[model samples]
Target: MSTLRPGRRFRTALRLAGIAAAFAAPPLAAGAVHFSRIAPLTGYAPAPAFDAPDIDVPFDPGKRTAVVVMSNTGTELTDFLAPYEVLAATGAFNVLAVAPEARITPLGAGLDIVPHLSFAGYDARIGADPDVLVVPFINDWRGAANRPVVAWIKAHAGPGTTLLTICGGAVTLAETGLLDGRRATTYWDFFAWVPRAYPAVQWVQGQRFVDDGNIVSSAGIANGIPATLHVVEKILGKAVALETARKVGYAPVAQLADPRFTLGMSPLPAVLLANAFRFDKTEMGVVLHDGVGEIDLAAVLDTYPRSGTTLTRLVADTRRVVRSRHGLFLVPRWDFASAPRLDRVVVPGARGALDDAPLAAWARDRHGVGVTYLRGDLGAPLAADRFPFDLTLADLARGESAAVARWSARGLEYTPEDPAVLAGAGWPIGIVVWPMALGLLGVALGTLGVRAVRTRA
Candidate 1:
């Protein structure tokens, strides 16, 4: 064998290093982009004001109307559903889900939803000012596409409507200038950015929800339950609110906010980075049917996808839209016959034995996939003083990886009831190790090929 010259050896080594770096850079860059998308570390530009002509909508004499506003592009899953379900369950108000357009609205990390009324539809049909107008976090809140939504909100900002903004929906509400000189709270992730974006609004930290008379704002996703219940108590009475809370299996807290939620440097960033960079992921199918519990569905759809190991799809027997228990319209993505082969099937809601058996059988017989339930006979009961999100976390810990469960909790800024479930969970070693191993192998192969070419020359 002819030994290489010193210059040739040095050049070969440089080529190998370059090959390794080329193999590694794409994934690293992509992971960083993915992480930034989820947790925005950058500053936000101020929201622009959209001038909307005031439309005098007459108030209905019969019952107070509540409209949960939806955007055609995307809305946060839990923020939209939890409040809608809780309010509808009380049966004290005429709760309606309205969208900017009549088209299907995609929810962030969940199924597509069809709102009951479009802005035009609501104007033509109800022709009444909503007593409560709920603004959920939408994907394109600051973009030009959201001008119509901003204008509609601004027009309805009179003293007659109670404006409730859930999570980052506070940003949207702030766009309407309603929260100016009002105490408001939002998702903890926004603490750094939103205040700078809207300095006119007094932003409160460590609060689950804030009520400055007509304008109300909730801290984050799961907190929507307690905040909405608080609204129920304000409108109906403590008795009705308590009953509604009991029905939903939620225990109300006396404190204005939980001090546990805040942002800082922690293992969460590393964990998020690992999950985002993970190459091997499972495709999970979620069954959508009529009368599915909105909270249950939201919990599964929101939690599993965040784990970074699972991709969720809304599957149904038919392609038609189905109504949730509280009346949020859900449009299924795939019919069972046409759906891609899935690693597993998730059945959400606390549907009783009669409803669950068919789903389990179909998942088993037709697809040969195992079924996981969000609640009821097959699934664990909601723990005492726990929300549906906690149930989802527990399921993630048990069914998937403990590390993934912790990641989901960290993403939501939620503290789990049992620390034991997430104990010892850390960054996925495979995410780092596998990529390094493959990169080394690629470099070695490239070096061998280069040497062979030199020998032939």
Candidate 2:
């Protein structure tokens, strides 16, 4: 197979990485993948060994343990701080920042933090028996030199104690063979390296976080806070977890399975940039067009930034077209030629109610055929009077929609409304979409002509 070329997906990721680099220094770690959104669970099977224990940890108000964080170059400081602050607020655990050497760590934005402990001159007695060991992300400090840190974790964590690592930090833990034969997750990038180095470990490609008994692994740096929150909830309770989220700007929907809170990398900047365009998500596909008027094919082709364009871009760049399983879609420009012909039609009434006159006309006058009108607005009656045709309008009674009725009438039926099915097919409707396209096209052209005349005169 061919190796590769500079592709759209590649450029977008590079641009996003560039923006992140401007905020913080480039990561010194070899290779770590930032995570996207987590995929849905496909299968469910119970594992007795993976079940949570019924017994609780003995409450000791003063018996809190600190998570030793080592700040290195390109280390995500917020990844460390978010969890540190949340853990502290719980009034259950304290955090002590440490470094490889006995010196101050220069965080991003000139915020200098002194290392509480140093590996060169290490002493665990200063801090309590850290019931939980958390390895904050380190962009550098890899290879044999990390043996001491790995040894310390193996020695310190007791049978009852738990060990946790976030993002690239998990790579360090994996080096210790503690993750062997265990299900784990890291920011998506390090996936290649983790499995290559630790063959025994089971790498979950799309999970936000996976709990293997006392060991917990999380996706990327973005999920560090939530992963720590999971630990807080496990050690403390749901009440404390919810309270911590409220204290921060985080939502309290941190159920162990919810990856939205933690699995993906920060999509704020990218989403913000994309939101500048009028994003219209339709049943057919997603449409990005000029909000001021109907879809301008030229503008769509010219206006979009190549680095930040979507997964699917239409030929006319201004509008992106997508289709669902049921043949529903969204397109910036109404291109009947690019759309599918529909035998069934439904028009909506004013005030967003359903209207059936158009369907009646299409069925009766144009062809001696029947059309099932599903409920939706068809805009103004552009040719409702002239193209008056005959059609039958049937109100879909409870559990009596055409889809079901068709299935009942015939053993098998056709569904034009399945998003997944439509999306997969990438079917275009060129012949039957003339009405929708021509009306919108005329409006667009007229508006442009008016603007041009005003500009010249």
State each model's CA lDDT, in order. Answer: 0.73, 0.42
For candidate 1, the clash count comes to 0
TM-score on alpha carbons, each prediction: 0.81, 0.43
> Local error of candidate 2 at 201, Å?
0.9
In candidate 1, what residue range of length 10 has the lowest lDDT sum?
Answer: 41-50
Instruction: Report the number of the highest-TM-score candidate.
Output: 1
* Predicted candidate 2, C-alpha RMSD: 23.4
| Candidate 2 TM-score versus the reference | 0.43
For candidate 2, write residues 207-310 as lDDT tens digits.
55677888887776546667777888888888888887665435434445475332212323332222222122111111222221111111111112111222
**Model 1, 48-136: lDDT tens per residue?**
12222222333345778999997876788889989998888888677888888766667755477767778998888887778889998
Q: Which stretches of candidate 1 lie over 4 Å from their true place?
A: 1-61, 255-266, 273-277, 351-358, 376-386, 420-429, 442-457
| lDDT at position 290, candidate 1 | 84
The TM-score that candidate 1 achieves is 0.81
Measured on C-alpha atoms, candidate 2 has an lDDT of 0.42
